[model samples]
Target chain A: MRIEAVALRYRYPRAASEALRGASVGAASGSSLAILGPNGCGKSTLLGALIGNIAPSSGRVLLGGRDLATLAPRAAARLVAFLPQFERMSFALSALEYALLGRAPRLGAFAQPAKADEDAAYRALEGAGAADLAGRRVNELSGGELQLVRIARCLAQDTPAIVMDEPTSMLDPAHARMVADAVRALAASGRTLVFSTHDAAFAAYAADEVSLMRGGSDQFRGPVAEALEAGRLASCFGVPFGAASAPSAFFR
Target chain B: MPRSPDDLRARSGKVLLLALAGLALLAFCLLAGRYPRPGLLDPRLLSSDATARAIVLGSRLPRLAAALLLGAVMAAAGNAFQMVFGNPLVEPGFLGVSQGAALGAALALVAGARSEFVVAGSAFGFALAALAAAALLARAFPFGGWVLRLVLAGFAVSAFMSAGLALVKYAADPLRELPDIVYWTMGSLSGASWRRLGFAAIPALGSTAFLVAYRWRVTALSADEAVVRSLGARPALSRALVLAIASAGVAAAVAMAGAVSWIGLVVPHAARLMFGADARRSMPASIALGAYFAALCDTIARAAFPGELPLGAVTAVIGSAAFVALLARGKVPVAR
Candidate 1:
């Protein structure tokens, strides 16, 4: 599915300033787009808009050519899956059970997941290299391992497009590289991917195109090579962006 | 908790066996009560003796039915509440449902409505009202997260209803209404009649079936909002569905058994320990196990003493002790 956010404008209720003011970006079918921004640049909010969680104050989003507003919530979910920043849950569920929950969109209200669903969930876990974690409680997993489980969950959703917010923020370099490889595999399989990150190296490794957001708007949208130039990167974050400023291979 | 398919199958087998064992216990309790001698009845006497037939058919049957229904209702309701709220500490009681029912029944009795139908109906009505009030108050707080807002609202409503119950008790005629209200709060099955059992069955059994039917999707409610959205389910709507169903079951149970505690909070966790945390297994596990536990406690309450003991007191003592033993064993998901 080709996801297009056409001039999205959103303001959190009673906030002093708008979180998104006419931000717009688009990803072609099976393409990966990297949303690069500093903290509070409305990247999460923009992702929220794409997933239909936050209604745009003006403008709109679309999947392929159909307006997102017209798609029922479950129908939209069948086409697009979303992963959020890490959060904890009080209840304990195994990784396989958690991943199989993604199939909920496909089942009828009274139907339980069958063997095929469980097989699909296991396939997704293996795809993300999390098969060994299938029986492990999600709450007991390390942050990086949990990220793999979350990716597996999205894979199980079987959507054409998947959006992830800061998927590598809690990972070590090795795990981050693993995620980059998985993201590449997902894109190579013809799934559209969009993710927000402050890590320029990870973004460069994973995304084909870049959308640099600043002040709640898309400051630049094009090839990552051009949009991630030192001058523009510095301007967005108010920090130096030379080779030394980039995330090091050893550590950030 | 079962991890593999084989283990899961084994756990299901174990659950089925436990259910059968519970049925046997119910039969034993049917013949064993404070029937002058406080012992099991002769099997042949049931068919030949009038007194044995009356005690077995009229008294033990209704009490056994009441125990089974109330126990299964509260524990399964608790399982749903824990999943929907994503907190092990939460149960139907945490939502003010019990307090609301107590207050409603107390007020009805104070107004000279002695009929079981009136008491149960009034209790069910007020229980729904309390849940509605909690939801409304939570919605009013638009800034905080939904889970936090719901917990805060529930706490406030529970306190308010409890105070209302106290006031009703204080204003009642000290000789008659006060004792009755106190007895109801202590939770006894002495009033178990066929009509009362019938009154509690619709909501109690119906809600349990609804929750068990939708058990898989209910896991989404325990997840973060993003997961719920990703799964294409409405978090608010699903959460409300779970809360409403569980609350109605608990309201009916409380109305019938009056303030029976601990089963809702403890048995679900025990089910999670044995069957894993997924509601699919744990919910049915809760139904079977809770019925056994409550029936056992009721048997002890009726037969272990010269006079009838309060069911609530016996359950709390045994329930907390069993929970402590489980915690000490170091195998279950206790609070997480």
Candidate 2:
């Protein structure tokens, strides 16, 4: 499936400036796309818009050539699975129970998860390497482990497209690499993967294409190599360009 | 990794023990009252003696049934409220729906509408008003989150209703209406009849059924909205619908039983302790445990003294002690 945004704009309530202004991008089928942006540059807002969590003030979002706003919640869910950056839970649900929630869209109204749903959830957990933690309470999981379980929940939805906002923002280097590898494997399995990241190394390793956002607008969109160029990276982050030190800062 | 036969037997025995305990409590509820009745083992008196039959089936049985139904409804509603709000501290009364019902009932009584229908009508109206206020606040302040908005709206509406109730009490004829209002506010099952039982039973059972059916989905509300939505559920709409149903059930029970406190707040916590917070298990366990607790409390209230004490008084005394004990034992964590 493909998703396209045209001239998108969004402003949070009571905020002085719009979070997103005329941002546009597209995700090709069965590919990985990374969104890179400085703090407060609308990366999260863009992810929200793509998943219909936030309504754009202007323009339209298209999924598989159909307008996103016109699609029913169930239909939209079947096509797109979204994992937000961080979610704090009030209840202490087991990790398996939390992951099984991903099968909700597939079940009928008022239906509990069947054997097939359980199978899907198990596969998702396995895919995200969270199978061993299934019985543990979500609150007990480490930051990286929780992110994997959250992704497993998205995987359980069995959607063709997955969108995540900084999926590895809180992970250590080893776990970050694991997450990046998982994203690459998901993209390889004919699923469209779209994620936002601040770590350039993860983006270099996983993203087929990269889109840079600055001041709530798309600064550039191109192949990973082109987008990661020293000059382009400096412009996107509003920092001094230094090619020699940039790669090591992310890689190490 | 296979379970041993003894372990399996022990598990089965534990289940049986719980079932027997539930049945014994129910039987004790039926037998303990102002008038003596034949024991559960002897069924002959129910068929032979008129007063025995009247006391057992007409009054005590219906009262027992109402207690059980209301208990289950309140507990289930409390569980739903806590889950949807993503706050374990929440209960059915958090959104002022109970107070709204109370305000409506008080207004009806003050206006001399003493019929059951009038009381229920006022209750339903004010319950809806409370729900609408919470929903509107949620929409108006999108950033405050549903729980925050609901709590704020509840506090405001509850304060308003409390003041209104005070006004009605002051304006009432102290000799006549004041006693009636005061008695109703304290809550009782003394007026329990088949009709009253029917009023509380239908809605209470209906709401419980709805919550049980959606128990799994309700658990998902603790996750991020985008994830829940991707799973084919509309988190906001589901939360609102569940809240409304749960509130309606509580309102119905309040209309019948007159603001019986503690069950809606405490029973869910008790169930969580025993059942480990899986709504599938917790919901049913809550229903059974709540019924047991309420019936047992009512039995104590009726038989503890020469005259029946108010149901609310009994519940408050017992509930506060249990809550404190649970806290002291570190069974229930302090709210963060």
Candidate 3:
């Protein structure tokens, strides 16, 4: 499915200023795009709009040439799967049980998961490299492991598009790379992948294309090489880009 | 390594054995009561004796049914509320719906509505009103998360209801209505009848079915609200619907069983302890465990003395002791 945003704008109910303003971008089917921005630049807001969590006050989000707001919830879920930046498992669901929640959109209103749903959960866990952790309680998993399990849950949705808000923000460097690789594999399998990240180097390695967000709008959008240039990076962040090198620990 | 078929069979046998033990406990509950003879097969009680039939059908049977239904309804409601709130500690009582019902009953008594219909109607009306108050509070304070607002509203409503109940007590006739209100508030199944059971069965069974069916979606609620919305569930709408259904179930059960306590709070935890916390398994387990516990408690209430004890008193005593023991064991996390 192709998702397009046109002149999108949004504001929190009581906030003094708008969170997003006049932002526009489009994601082609089966492509990987990374949103890069400093904190408070509306990256999460943009992701929220794309996933239809928050309505755009002034513009429209189009999914497959149809208005997102007009689509039914189950139909929207069947098309796009989203992973939020952070999640807390309130119940003591086992890893596999948690992953099976991804199949919710496919089941009948009152029906439990069938064998096929279970198989999908298992496969998604294996795909996300979290198969071994499936039997353990989710609360017992480390941060990185839990992140992978959540990704597995998203994968189990079998949606055409996946949007994640800072999937690797809380992980260690090694686990971040592993998550990045998993996203890359998902893109390679002919699924559209859109993710937001602050880590520039990780975005460089993972993104097929990059979009820079600043002041609640898209500043630049192109191949990573052009978007991640020293001049653009410095301007976006308002810092001298090479004075303090990108953390070497991230690259290692 | 793969388990052999023989090993799997042995495990299944152990499970069957435990199930049989549970059944034995249920049988004991059915047989033990205030009557002089306490055997299930005792022909003396079933020999067309009017008093015996009155004891069996009028008192014992209805009480047992009330206990089982109350347990099942409370446990199911508790599970749903806890899941929707994303807190295991939440229950129908914690949300102050029970207190609201109690206040409704007390107010009806003071107003001279002595009929059963008036009592059940007032109880349900105030229960829904309490829930509406919680919903309004949540909307009014959108800055606080949904759970926080709900919990705060519950406390507020509960305090108001308690004060109202106390006022009713003060206004009541000391020799007549006051004692009746006090006995009712403490809770009992002595008033159970087939008609009362039929009236309550609708909401109780209906809500239990809804909870069991929607058990899978409850897991999605653990994610962020945005994520839950993206996953085809309107988090706010679904939560409100579940709360209404679950609270209505509690109201019905309370109306029938006269404010039975502890089942809603403790039964879900017991189910979680026995079965892993998958709502699919936990919902059924909660129902079964609740029925079992309620039956056991009712049996003790009936048999512990020559006359029946208040069901709520018995449950509170047993539930508090069990809760303390569970905490002292230090197996489950104390705080989430």
Which candidate gets the maximum DockQ versus the true structure?
1
Error of 3 at A34 (Å): 1.1
lDDT of 1: 0.87
Task: Give a tens-digit lDDT track for model 2, residues B85-201.
Answer: 777667787777777777788888888996887887787688768778867766776567555776787777778777878898899889878887888788888788888777667
lDDT of 3 by residue, A110-144 (tens): 77888789889989999999998888888889999
Candidate 2 residue-wise lDDT, A43-85, digit = tens: 8899888988888999899998999989888888888999888
Candidate 1 per-residue C-alpha lDDT over B165-233 given as tens digits, one digit per residue, 9 for 90 to 100: 999999999998999889888898988999999989998999999988988877767788878977898
Best by lDDT: 1
Per-prediction TM-score to the true structure, in the order listed: 0.96, 0.92, 0.93
**Candidate 3: RMSD to truth:** 2.7
Give lDDT per model, in order.
Answer: 0.87, 0.81, 0.82
Question: Candidate 1: misplaced stretches above 4 Å?
Answer: A245-252, B1-5, B325-336
By TM-score: ranked, best first: 1, 3, 2
**lDDT of model 3, residue A172:** 93
DockQ of each: 0.57, 0.47, 0.55
Alpha-carbon shift of residue A53 in model 3 (angstroms): 0.4
lDDT of 1 by residue, A89-181 (tens): 666788999998888889987788898988999999999999999989987898889899989999999999999999899899888888888
**How well does chain A score by TM in each candidate?**
0.96, 0.95, 0.96
lDDT of 3 by residue, B1-336 (tens): 122588568646755764786788766766676455544535365676777677776767777887888999998898888778877766777666788888888888878886987887788788778878877876787577777887888888888888988988999988878877888788887777888888888988898888888876765665567767877988888888888888989988887777777787778877787667888777887888888888888888878777789999998999878777777886344335
Ranking by lDDT: 1, 3, 2
